[model samples]
Target: MRTGKPSKTAIKVSSSIVTLGTTSYGQQILPDGLVDASEKILLASGVVSEKGVRWIKSPRMVSVYRAFDWLLPGQFEALGERKAFFERQVRAGIAAGATQILVLGAGFDTLGWRLATEFPKVKFFEIDHPVTANVKAKAVSKLGRRGNLYLIAEELGKRKLPDVLATHGSWNRESRSVILAEGLLMYLPAQAVRELFGQCLAIAGAESRVVFSYIPAGPDGRLDAGRWTGLMLWLQKVAGEPWLWSIEPQNIRSFLEGIGWKIAPELEGGTGRHSTEYFAVATNQA
Candidate 1:
C-alpha cells in the first residue's frame, strides 16, 4: 500500500479487511463467512502463509472492534441488526423470484461467495472499482470454481453504471433482480446517488429490490444532529474515505417514493448507536 500508486479503492477494501477480521473474532455476528472471506483477502494481499493468516485475531483487530464501539455508541447491537436485515433481504429476494443479484460497490463483501449455494439458481455479481475488483477476483478464483458468480471490475464513470453493468455481463431489465448498495450510498454525493438510482430504475423490473445502508442526520446537513459527527468525520479522514451524504430518516420513504419505489415499512428498522445510522430496503412496483 505504501510503495505502489495509492488507490482509494484499496483503502476502502482494506477497511473491509479489518471489518471482516473483527466479525471473525467476535461471536456476535457472522464469523464463519467473514473468517473464510478474510482468508481470501489475505491470499489476495499476499499473506498466504498460515502464520500470517493468524494475524486476523491479533491486537490490531481488537483495536478495530474497540474503535467500532467508539464510533457508534451501541455499535455491536446496531451492526448485528444490520447483518440480520441484510440476510433477511437476501432470503426475501429469493422468495420473490429474483434470479440475479448485483452487489454495488461490493468492496470486500463475500456474500457472493458465501450465499452462492443457498440460491443455486441465482446469478451473483460483485461489482467494484477495477483495482479492488482485480484483487478480489484473484482471491476468489483460488476459492474453487464459481460460474454463476461473476466479479465485475469497472469504474463508475459519468453516471453510466447501467452501461457498465451491461458491458461486463447480462443486464436483464425484464428479470426480477435485487441490487444491493450496502455500505456504499453514504460515500457518494447526492447527485451521484440520484444518478445511481436512475440507472437502477431503468434496468430493474417491478419486483426488483434495492437494499442499502445510509447514515442518518438532521436538517442543515449535520450528521446525527451533531452526535459523534466530529469523531465520524475524523475517522473517515484518517481512513481516507469520507462519508459524503447523510439522509434524514423521516424523509427516506418520501425520497424513494418520488423516485418510483414502494418503500417497505420495515426498511428503516435497524442499524445505529442511538439510531445514528440505518438500513432500508425498497423496490419499484410499477
Candidate 2:
C-alpha cells in the first residue's frame, strides 16, 4: 500500500478465496454461502471476464495454485482455516447479542456481505483503504446494496479509527459490536496497533468483542520461522506492505488488558515449530 494504490495482498487474497471456494479443500473449510458470496464478488469486480471466470474454475489453474502452495507450505490451508475460524467467531458474537459487525482493513473478504444477508437485523460495516475499498464498493454495488451493510473507505493507519468511523452516519457507537481485524495488525506499527484497539474500545459498547489475527514472534522474541521467515518478509516488502508488529503469545493478555480488553480463554498457538500465525478473541468488558 502506497497512498493511492490498492493493496496487492488484498487482490491476491480475493483470488485465493475464489480458488479455495471452487476447490474441494476449500469447500471443506469454508461455509457454502461464503464461497458463493465470494464467487459473486469475483465476477462483480470485473477483474475477469465471464468466460475467464469459467477459466478460473479449471483444474489447471487450481493445480497451479496448489503448486504455489507447495512453495509456500501450509499457506493455502492456513488461509482457508483462518477464514472459517473468523466466521465462527463472528457467528458466536452475533449469538452472544452483538448488534453490529465492524471489520477493520476488511480487504476483499465476503464475510460481511454474506453475514449481512444471513443476519439482516445486524448492521455490518467494513472499513478499508480508499483504493481497496473502492474496488470492493464497485463489486458490492453490482450485487445490490444491503441497507445494513456499510462500506467505508479510509486509510486506517493514517487516520484515527474513531474519527473515520464517526463520520459515517450509519455507524452506531452505542451498539454492541464484534470488531474484526483479520490479517491487519501485523501490517501496522506497534503504536498504531495500540491506538486501533483503544479506538475500537472507545467506539464499542460494553461487552463488545474483537477477533484478530497476527504473526507471533518466536521464542527468541523475533518474527523468525526458520527458512521461511526471510522469504515471507521479502514477499510482503516486495508488495510494499511489510510485517511490522507482533506480540508474544504469553504477553497478549497483559497487552490487551493495558488497552481495556481481556483475552478469551482459547488462545491460539504462537510462532512455534507447528505454527507461525496466531488468532485472538478479546472482549471489551469496559
- Predicted structure with the largest lDDT when compared to the true one: 2
TM-scores of the models, in the order given: 0.82, 0.91
User: Which residue pairs clash within candidate 2?
Assistant: none
RMSD of 2: 2.5
lDDT of 1 by residue, 1-286 (tens): 1112224544344344444445533445553465556556655645344565555446675566567665566554454455556766877788879888888877666777777876788888877777667767777777754778888876554538667767765667788889988777777788888778878888777788898888887776566624578887777766666778777878888888887776776544543333455777888876
Question: What is the per-residue lDDT of model 2 for residues 1-286, given as tens digits with 9 covering 90 to 100?
Answer: 5766767777666667777777778888887677667767867876556786676667877888777664466776677778877888888889989999999998888988888888999999999988888978999999988888999988887777778878887778889999999889989989999999999988998888999988777788877544578888888888899988887878889999998899886533332222456777899874
lDDT of 1 at 185: 78
Worst 10 residues of 1 by lDDT: 1-10
CA deviation > 4 Å runs, candidate 2: 49-52, 266-275
Scored against the true structure, residue 23 in model 2 reaches a CA lDDT of 76
- How far residue 150's Cα lies from its native spot in candidate 1, in Å, is 1.3
What lDDT score is found at residue 31 in candidate 1? 35
Error of 2 at 255 (Å): 1.3
